[model samples]
Target: MMNILKRVITVLLCLILIAVAVVYFYMKQPQFGALPEGVRLERIKKSPHYRDGKFRNLEEKPTIAEGYSLVGELWESLTKDYPRTAPKDSLPSVKTNLKTIPADRNVIVWFGHSSFFLQLDGVKILVDPVFSGKASPLPWGVKAYKGSDIYTAEDMPEIDYMLLSHDHYDHLDYETVKALQPKVKYVICGLGAGSHYQKWGYTGRQIIEKDWGDKQEVKPGFTIYTESTHHDGGRGFTSSQALWLSFFIQSPSMNIYYSGDGGYSTRFKKISEKYPSIDWAIMECGQYNKAWQSVHELPEEVAQATTELKAKNMLPVHHSKFTLAKHSWDEPLERISALSQSKNYRLATPMIGEVIRLDDPAQTFKQWWKAVK
Candidate 1:
């Protein structure tokens, strides 16, 4: 009995050591250029991890219990208990000819999820682009819906700037980034995310890392500032070891906010206070459940959160592209539109690849999902 117990302990220690070594190797910071002049490392005052009026060093969270069940249930439905009815209509298709933007004001096009293709003052920018067929660490893990080929990285026009929110597999695809690296002039990322890109061989013009509220003017008319999000950032093991953020783009003609996957918080009100009457807010509206309340905002909360931002117009994303949640795929749109109608918020109906003229924020999105399912 004594020999067996000692062997078990040895095996456990070996397993622990192996995990530590792998994490250290994968999570090492990359050699990159100096962060921009205004950028600095800092912590949020009122974050959940704060205590005694000081920021607590975030401990490594082994796993998130809250969202674990949601992911498990979603997996079961996809594998074992899929609906008897056929899957909904595949995502909308974009025209073959990728639309060109005139050297003029700002135009935003949704590539599904939080990814958006923007041309402001003739500078092309792609935000949170993930062109891979899946949003998982492995290509075979979680597949995206079929038939929604609005644009691929190969189809993309020369991208002047690539803005990333974090290093999650979904947002920062290794294959997509490697393919587009040559054409991309500049890459911007939240603090610590540059480490991931560095591992993936992003040596040329390393990403511009910024803390929340840190602003950088990419050019004359296009400026990007990091904003707050109630979410943790890290690909695996460590929690908040890296920074997660939203981008606030200020152009000559428009000011827009991209809420990259976050739970509801007073930060929206703070952002609204900072930039009142934001022209358009690209917000998350899907892949949410109450189990993960602190990580993602539900459809109803999305409406309330937008009201807090005081946005003039809003576009719903993070849905219709990937099946990341167990809820009926189209449920987010159905619920959010109802909530938006109740709140009287101006919502834009932007099909994948459809150009949303920033100046004319009056278009209503068709109930595309209703017909889809």
Candidate 2:
């Protein structure tokens, strides 16, 4: 009995050591990204929002809401039978060749999720592009829907400014950014997010790393302002090593807003006061759940944020491509469309890769998902 027990213990110890070794090496891979260090870490320490060794939100909300446990949420997400979490068939999309689109045209093209391209006063900007087909560190996780990923890095036009909202996997995919490095001129992201780009071979000169309320003029009359939002980001075990942010672009003809990913807070009203005349706002509205009400806004909060900003038109994003939450993929679109009827903003629901004329407020979009599944 003693001999058998000794053998079992030896085998278990060896297995435990192997598991630890595997994880250590896996995390060492470049995809997990480097944490804020050296000059970047020094800059992060000086931010007004930095507190207790991590960047803090103006509104202090728990990552998971009061009553939920992380383990419970994960179990429910895995075990629960959420109906239609992904479309039953290939989602309908219009692939207007991006490279062929006239450079002079003022437009916005959403590549689904939070990735999008914008041309204002002839300066082209791409935001949070994740074309790696998946949104996780592990290869098989959260794959993009069939037709949603038709747009690749090779298809993109020359990008004057690439806006990386934060360092989260879905927003900042390694494979996607590396492929577009040659065509991209500058990358505008929050304070420490530049660390990841630097590791991926993007020149430090090509990155515009800034704090919460800093502003930059990339082109004549085209100013990009980095603003605060209530979200968290990190690629490795230590999270919120950098600030999470949104952008308010002041173009010569019009103004635009992009909320990368954030929960609902009083910050929206502050943003409206700061940039009083917003032409169009692209807000994050998907992959939200009740437990994460303070992490990503529930659909109701998304509607309220739009109202507070008083945007002339709003394009609801952060949905329709990947399933990060348990809700049906079409739920975000369906809910927000219903809520917008009484709101001040006209909801712009363009199909994936379809060009939307920024000046055309009267343009209409089909309830495209209704026909898909």
Candidate 3:
């Protein structure tokens, strides 16, 4: 009987080892990406925000909100009511020909989630472009909504600059980067994020990684200032090896602020105090829950942040493509729209691939998601 018990224990150990091996193999795939190393590591360590081998936010933040148990939240997310997490029908979208967009026109087109195409002063900039149709390391994980992926690399024109906010799978897709490599001129991202681009075949000359508070004049009339965000970054099991950031883009014709994935913080007010006036604020307004409130902002908080930033107009993003949270997919738009109305904040709600004329600050879009069901 003792021999039989030992045999059972041996079999269980073998099974556990096999499972661990499988997981390790899967994580080593190119999609998981390489972390900052060697020279990149040295550069990251120089930042004042770097501490104890990881970058830190302005203040200490918990990944999960106060009083929330990580295990309990995960269980609830796995087995809770998540109605309308996806649209019932294909979402409505316009297929704009990027190459044909006039060089003189300043326009912005969103491709759902955090990806956006910006054309100003004949310079084409693509931000957090994930046109690969999925937002996860595995193909089945975090698939995009139907009709949301109307734009692809093939549809893109020669890009002047590609702005990557962080190294998260949703923001920095491996396949998308490879597909756009031939047409891309420069890759701009937060500190240590260029390691993944280097691993994926981009040379040092093609990438520019900046720490928080770093400013660069990319061109004669265009300047970029990196600012802090209340978030963390990593492509693999580790976290915060690189910085997460928002960008204040100053151009001759416009001033735009992009709040990469972040929770509500005093940083918004700081940005307003520094910039004085932002012509357009592309803000994150979705994929939020109390469980992860410290990382992502609630819809009301988005409105408050917009007000704090002194932005002339707000374009809500980080929704309508993938359902990362349990709330109804359209809930963000509904809530932000109502809040903007009550607070008298100007809001821009363009459909996927619909061109937004930057000069027309008063331009409005139809409630496109209302017809999705």
Give the alpha carbon lDDT tens digit for every residue of 162-244 in model 3: 99888898899999998898899998898888889898989898999998888878689889898989988998889988789
Q: Residue pairs in steric clash, candidate 1?
A: 349-365
| lDDT of residue 138 for candidate 2 | 97
* Candidate 1: tens digits of C-alpha lDDT, residues 1-373: 9999999999999999999997676545331112211223333333454345332223332233454675775676668754412235776655533445566756788887777788877778888888877787643677777665456788778888899876666677777887788778778876656656666677737567666778988778778888777776656654454567788888777888889887777788889899886878889888776767666788878898889988888888887777776677777777877788866568876677777778765555667656665
After superposition, the stretches of candidate 3 with alpha carbons farther than 4 Å from their true spots are none
TM-scores for all candidates: the values are 0.79, 0.98, 0.98
* Model 2 lDDT per residue over 1-373, tens place: 9999999999999999999999999999999888889988998899999989998998887889889989999998778898888887887788878877786889999999999989888898999999989999997688998899988999888999999888999999999999999999999888888888899999988988888999998778889999998989899889998788899999889999988799998989999999999999999999999898887988889899999999999999999999898899999999999999999889999899888999876789888988888
Local distance difference test scores for all models: 0.71, 0.90, 0.91
Global lDDT of model 3: 0.91
In order of listing, the candidates' clash counts read 1, 0, 0
